[model samples]
Target chain A: MTNVSAELDSRFRAAAAEEGLLDVAYDVVDSPLGELFVGISDRGLCVISYEADPDAQVERLARGFGSRVLRSTRPVDPARRQLDEYFEGKRKRFDLDVDLRLARDFGRTVLEELGRVPFGEVTTYGELAARAGKPRAARAVGTIMNRNPVPIVLPCHRVVGANGSLVGYAGGLERKHQLLRLEGALLA
Target chain B: MEPVRIPPFETFYEEHKDPVFAHLRRLLGQGAEDAFQETFLRALRAYPELRNGRHLRAWVFTIATRVAIDETRRRRPMASPWLHELAVEDGLPPHAELGHLTDNLPPKERAAVVLRYGFDLPYDEIAAALGSSEDAARQATSSGVRRLRERSKRS
Candidate 1:
């Protein structure tokens, strides 16, 4: 069996990108938290999950986007850079374009509002719900945070409970705490 | 009933890329690289809609065969009348390289012979790859082998 040479593999990726056949391009980047599986579509950066099984992450991307997902780092380079800056506390706000296609309707709305919560600020879930134009949807907003597809980019970690306690982070509350502390929203 | 689990395209591509490349190399030789890229690009474009993973090997091979045929026809617009005559009567030239010999066969026969002998795919799978009935695939393989054997005898 002839092994695919790196040159040929890169050529295939370039051709696929030119033909618009690469629907989702992803890469794994090292971060202060851990390895992040970053997935980007032509629209923008879409998935930013804490490292788990790489195969499982790719499968989820295939299910959400088209199955034309590939491991091309160039498409994800900007996100990686920004994430690195954020973890190092050198960047105050993410200037990167985020693809929220994985989240929809109210979840999309809440996440969008969450992005504007600033780098060193914290907001209650009820405040986020009100900003999303549904004050009664605080519980629903919490659920959306639990399923935030692009968490760090969307600032899901800045959200807290009404009692000012860290709660309902899908990546675990400890990660949420660490993120908040990194942004100086919580004391280190 | 449990739903069929279609593997991610990455997994699917990894599993089939080398074999598909080998099949295309047999059929298209130097042009296999381009045809191999086309086959996988086409596969990736249609991967999300695929509901069944059971026939993925056949599916990819089918794509590779079509790509090879298209590449061949593009290069030689009109089929060479002499090649057809040789296939029907005296067989291909004995000294011809295996790639050149197979390249001169009719598209279906070339695909059948490559899929069956080169890859050792079962006849039913060959039928799927060639998009023909199993009996037809069997007949094509036998005919293709006979032509190659006849050429060998003449040498």
Candidate 2:
């Protein structure tokens, strides 16, 4: 290896040594949008940032895990593997446990409501708020979505604007459109 | 640089997945998945233009690099020790002589060399990927190799 490569590898190894602290599990899942980053904990899938802003999301994740989050990539990441299967349409349901500790109360509540949004169908922002027992909080639902720690797993994209228009997806509206289309939820 | 046609999303993933992931992993250092996801998302949003397939790799790299650099600016974690070690090894004489001199450059230069040498891209492509001019990309890669040669001679 060249001197620069050697030095880079050394730093990488040093970071890898801290792997013991990062028990966070990860995987790459196939999505209608393409390959995606899916991370899980014992509770459920914790992080589901799209491919582009993965590190930004990782930094956000570190706040939840504290210093235990390490920097590394593993193809064998269970979450990624399962997600791959999921997007390939081979796996209809995910069995991975996720860490929900990072979710705030409203966020958790919104996510739970989102989970009820059966696959192959879609819901509205207001409808989701009503399901969450916050009928007046339709816009708050949008805020909850902006803060959603997990997207596809929680199915946040399944929720649309009150007017039934596709709007405000954190993962990008086109992805939201595509995911909805893939699940056969996009209305003509 | 050639114009790149954005293939059907599914087709794009199947054909370019490995190289794209490899690029993202290398560019972002860590958190490659997020960069990878973001890259496709951006592509999804701006699909019609990424035609021609000629500069497709460079285009993808450009997005990944921007996303990674943005993340780095936001979250500046120390490089992993392994990364440091790899950088050091790349500076050694044996590596330089092998023309494997590509490995240990600074992260940005390393990225440029990898895209240029490993992928056989032209300087324009590398510059586009890096959001710099061809001259800048050339300078970065040249300087990076020059430094490697200097370090190799000393070692």
Candidate 3:
């Protein structure tokens, strides 16, 4: 992005927003853990990240989406609003549109199964892999969960260890436990 | 003529955003972003019909300058003081701050000066962008420059 006047950049953003030409528009929203960058494609919310480095994401999105990505708040507004509600314990299920184009094949299959885990429900990685028709591929399920493009909305945090221990989360185990606790999956 | 092959909008955006944005910022004062948006919006709308790839840069600049000038007319019937305070603290380029430079001149002269010196547009291209004769564009730029010099000296 060149150093255009802030006003012009905003105007450009507004028009892109109006036309829905922003291939991947994103904005940062605050959560109890930290700031999260929420991105959306025209179809639905696409990517969420713990890191908000614009330059790196811009390059990454350009390569992935084949268009310019901008920091448009409007497209991701619903995602932000819903995430806010979920984090606040006011909402249990997310009804936002999701673009899962970034997920492929087994990863896509694994995520779809994970999305069905429901709020306040817990499933083991092996259970998730079995639902995706690859019971022995529990490790693969874990890998897919780690790279889940849209995390909380997909409910990867609901996937616990096969032994029912809190194992791993892309956002860290503490966040995973917190999310489960918020959902009443954990007594504490 | 067969339509010139324009890259996808995302590719175009990645490739040209900086130059186009920098150009609009230099041409317009405060709300250059709006102009940048409008310019690209119009360009994208007409991109399919653009016949010559070689003229893309100049073409984008043409739309940018016009959008910028049009924005000047649409918003800000009266200049605000916030831009004034920002300009006074100008540690960088004097004209780069914009509010003072934009307020001091009429819209046409401002466009001419911004295109000429700010963007280094030749008189012919500036005239094309301004929808006037080259000679008139040259005169407008000259007068706009003289006013800026006098204002700076007084300040």
DockQ for all models, in order?
0.50, 0.02, 0.21
TM-score-wise, the better of 1 and 2 is 1
What is the per-residue lDDT of model 3 for residues A50-123, given as tens digits with 9 covering 90 to 100?
77666666667656774446676677778888999999999988998888887899999898888889899999
Per-residue lDDT tens digits for candidate 1, residues A47-159, read: 88886567988988888887778887677878889888888889988888888877788888998899899988999999999999999998999889888888888888898
What tens-digit string does per-residue lDDT give for candidate 1 at B1-155? Answer: 55567777777877888888877776667868889889988887888778877778878888887777678667765552224434444454533245566777887887787666544567886886776789999999889878777666775
Each prediction's TM-score against the native?
Answer: 0.77, 0.47, 0.65
Question: Which 10 successive residues of model 3 chain B have the least lDDT summed?
Answer: B80-89
Of 1 and 3, the candidate ranking higher by DockQ: 1
For residues B1-155, write the lDDT of model 2, one tens digit per residue. Answer: 75543333334444554566666566555666666656655654454444465656666676666565556545543432223433454543233223234435676787665555434567876786776789999988777767766766776
Q: Please tell me which predicted candidate would have the highest DockQ against the true structure.
A: 1
Off by over 4 Å in 3: A1-8, B1-34, B43-155
Question: Which has the higher TM-score value, candidate number 2 or candidate number 3?
Answer: 3
Which candidate has the highest lDDT of all? 1
The better candidate by TM-score, 1 or 3, is 1
Chain B alone, candidate 2, TM-score of: 0.49
Give the lDDT of residue B9 in candidate 1. 72
Off by over 4 Å in 1: B1-6, B28-31, B46-52, B69-110, B113-136, B142-155
